[model samples]
Target: MSDGIIGLIGIVALLTLLLLRLPVAFAMFIVGFLGLWIVDGWNVAAGLLSSETFTLASKPELVVIPLFILMGNVASASGMSRQLYDAAYSLIGHVRGGLASATIIGCGGFAALSGSSVASALTMGKVSLKEMERFKYDDRLSTGSVAAGGTLGILIPPSTGFVIYAILTEQSIGRLFMAGILPGILLLMVFVLTVLILCLIQPSFGPPGPKTSFSEKRRALVGALPILVLVLVTIGGIYRGFFSPEEAAGVGAGLAILYGLFTRSLSFSALKEAITDSVVTTATVMLILIAAHLLNPFFALTHITETVGNFLAYLDLSVLGTLLFILAVYLVLGCFLEGFAMLVLTLPIFFPVVLELGIDPIWFGVLVVLTLEMGLISPPVGINVFIVKSVAPRVPLGQIFRGVIPFWLAMVATLGVLIAFPQISLFLPNTMFN
Candidate 1:
């Protein structure tokens, strides 16, 4: 009878739909529109739906989605991602577990360019998997490293995850982008260490790759320089306050296109394909965001965020304790839900609670994104794991999952370190911009 009860039922039904294989955007749309109509009336629901869809559709900030995606798609078409991976591999592949480390580093570099975990995993897997196979690297370590490393795309700058979080929470996209840098690098280092530890324990898991001659290393670095420069230009420009997030996206996309053409790598057909892919990806993201908007108002009508905030305060947990509890919930939910789905479902309720506790929005965004990264590699529905599986079909799904366990622990450690010192997430944003 109460709005709260109605909201609860709607959430349950939404989850049921998801379990029944409904698309996330449509499921949210159906439940959100119906719940709003039930809570208010058909007229109000119709007005809200029409207005929200148009507003989200026309948002200037949304342009970043397509542009960043285009930059990545074009980069993939141009072989820029492979060049980056080759550069990393040339430098580190000779060391024990070095190939895996190179894969992680390559994933991080590609993450900076693409900002999509699926893109990073798919691209890097195509580039690195065969090489690792040639080097006799264990399929588990090779596939696991690719899957786990790809999760960096969410935390690295130019990330769609940060973009979506910024739009949803009304946080500063540039600041959130800056905030993610150190944490992203930290996580990359942790993953490299995980590879080292795994190889140290079992010497053959990731056998050393062939040593490259100094000339080969130099050539590889030269080949990747264009991408490295592009990454620095876009992310560094934003950090320096020389460009807004949208402008940065435009600049990055333009540069990606020019690079592809100048290198004679992206033909007209490939360029068209890149544009089509970017459009489709951007459209999917926009629809999900619009659906989230619908559900958000319905949740507000039920006072769920307020209710949850009140309950959190009633418990009187210390700020750290409360934060940990929230993250634990994300960890559990990650097993069953896709990362963006979890973000849309939970942020409306939890973000307000985070602010009430006086946490920094930028810092919290990094933490939340990192948790989402965990979910991307989490079991049952680890989307990145599945992406890697698709790339290396010969490797059993269970073995890939098993391989991710060490990297998953590495993620847990990274989370703990960030939690212990929030400045890890905050320092770059504060120092570089403020």
Candidate 2:
């Protein structure tokens, strides 16, 4: 059989494994290893396995993953996330649908610290859901806001999603980080607007919360100050070229630990748990990266990426049409596949087409990440919906799914805006780097 045919078979096998509910890392590893052995030889396959694994494991840039994860874990364990929520609530809780809006704003702040949708959703859900319930906010709106807002974790600065995309595409992590800023803010605003409109339409969906006095607002903001400063320092330091992304991560992690210790909010046991969680999460990400590296070489050997790129080129679509087509595929895959799995599986095939079409990689990275965010709240496999359900167990899964629909549509609108105005994604990076 032709190598291309072998590649196609390998892809089918990989998908079969995934559909069988095998772990993503293992499924990719199996497909990559076997495909390499079949198309080249066992020796080449074995050599790549060892080398790629070591190469990814020891890479300095990847240290950002563990460090940023640790920062997030420490922040969550130490009540920084709670402080952020409290601050947001104090500032906005008096408005109609204020509680849900506050939850989204808090989610955005926590996302900056955590760079994890699951963490953002879980932490904010724990902090805000009970409070919203106390205030009689509708479960659909409350749960929906958390699910939708948590997705911001992947699009904001220090995002693990961007890091993975950067590694896969060999783009500058800093540039990608910068590129995500404006688009992230835009999505956050869109989410808040969705909450406002929902509350306006139904009124009962979100009741106006009690207005806090200025003193109370100041106190809440003061409580959240350390995290706010940490975010600025790490992200700003990167923008200013004072440190690389890895250094910024280390600094953020160290500061988070120090703040927790200083405030006596992070006990020895909590700190230990944070470390353990960070290690486990970091290991999982590394394994996936290594597996992707292996899988990419297999595709290269089979010339699958080239063949796919050629096929797309022959379609004679406008650049915008081609871009939209690829994004549509992502939206479909997202319904069934986990976000990271979908990313690793498809980027090798689609990214070359993106590059060949002269689409800016950094801008494309932002667009791709935004689409992944939509997938997080999309039905069936909506990971963030599931995360929200775990936190708000009394709420029906169907309710949470219903809640996320409006926000999902809001995301769709935001995606359209970003596509129409690519400058929204590119402006920050261009201004900062150029």
Which 10-residue window in model 2 sums to the lowest lDDT? 425-434
- Tell me model 1's lDDT, rounded to 2 decimals: 0.92
Residue 239's C-alpha lDDT in candidate 2? 88
Candidate 2 per-residue lDDT, tens place, 1-434, comes to 99999999999999899989999999999999999999999999999999998888887999999999999999999999999999999999999899899999999999999999999999999999999999999999999999999999999988999999999989999999999888999999999999999998999999999999999999999998998899999998898888899999999999999999998999999999999999999999988999999999999999999888888888989999999999999999899888899889999999988988899999999999999999999988999999999998999999999999999999999999999999999888888734
lDDT of 1 by residue, 393-413 (tens): 899999999989999999999
Rate residue 51 of model 1 by lDDT.
98
Best by lDDT: 2
Model 1, residue 79: C-alpha shift (Å): 0.3
Candidate 1 runs further than 4 Å off:
none
